[model samples]
Target: MPQNKAAIATQDAPAAIGPYSQAVRSGDLLFTSGQVGFDPASGALVSGGVEAEARQVLKNLAAVVGAAGLQMTDVVKTTVFLADMNDFAAVNAIYAEAFAGAEVMPARSTVQVARLPRDARVEIEAVARFA
Candidate 1:
């Protein structure tokens, strides 16, 4: 049987710069593309350090998830890519605060990558489930 899939998009998040959807919904799950620290209105990475960029990344992810008719609390997993491992603590702090009130924090994996799109300090992607 063929699966039904739909692309999710929102003006609140920066548009994809390449040939990829912002997020794709397959059945009950929504898989979002990795979101860099680009500001939707400006189409540029947010100015500042890792912490600031991480904040914007989360906001972008939130916008994608929200467009799929889900909330941040619905996220079940996440993968974070960072340009530097040294920024882990700062990004972790921001990540924790971003999902503070959730009933259960999503499982996450964070790793240092050699580089990221637009030289962003951070990028984040999420998987959310809907009942």
Candidate 2:
């Protein structure tokens, strides 16, 4: 951790499974690490399907963003990663619903990846500005 940036953590979100912080705040921006569908309490990926996973992923991101004293509406950009491109529609719907309250929807990029940690259906990361 450098003096310019501080790592963010929250019990409301699942702990990082690797050598990374849940998020890091530097200057006016907060950058959240990618979050999957795992529940913080159970430490297990939520059941259902891509939609369920997408919802959980947003919840996890909200927790991380909130930990830094920001809200979903503050998010400026987001990157969504999916294990399968076929799940895009389902995840997109969930993603839209999660940030529906935002005055200006965050810019976004979604991509399909070969695999994800814990085999999650979807993962998301965000950049938010609180200052």
Q: How accurate locally is residue 5 in candidate 2, as Cα lDDT from 0 to 100?
A: 91
Superposed model 2: Cα runs more than 4 Å off: none
**Ten contiguous residues with the weakest lDDT in model 1:** 44-53
Instruction: State how far residue 54 of model 2 sits from its true place (Å).
Output: 0.6
Model number with the top TM-score: 1
User: Candidate 1 residues 1-131, lDDT tens each?
Assistant: 88699999999999999999999999899999999999999998898889889999999999999998899999999999999999999999999988997999999998899999989989999999997
Worst 10 residues of 2 by lDDT: 48-57
What is the model-wide C-alpha lDDT for candidate 1?
Answer: 0.94
lDDT of 1 at 108: 93
Give the local distance difference test score of model 2. 0.93
| Candidate 2 C-alpha lDDT tens digits along 7-93 | 999999999999999999999999999999999999999999888888899999999999999999999999999999998888888
Clashing pairs in 2: none
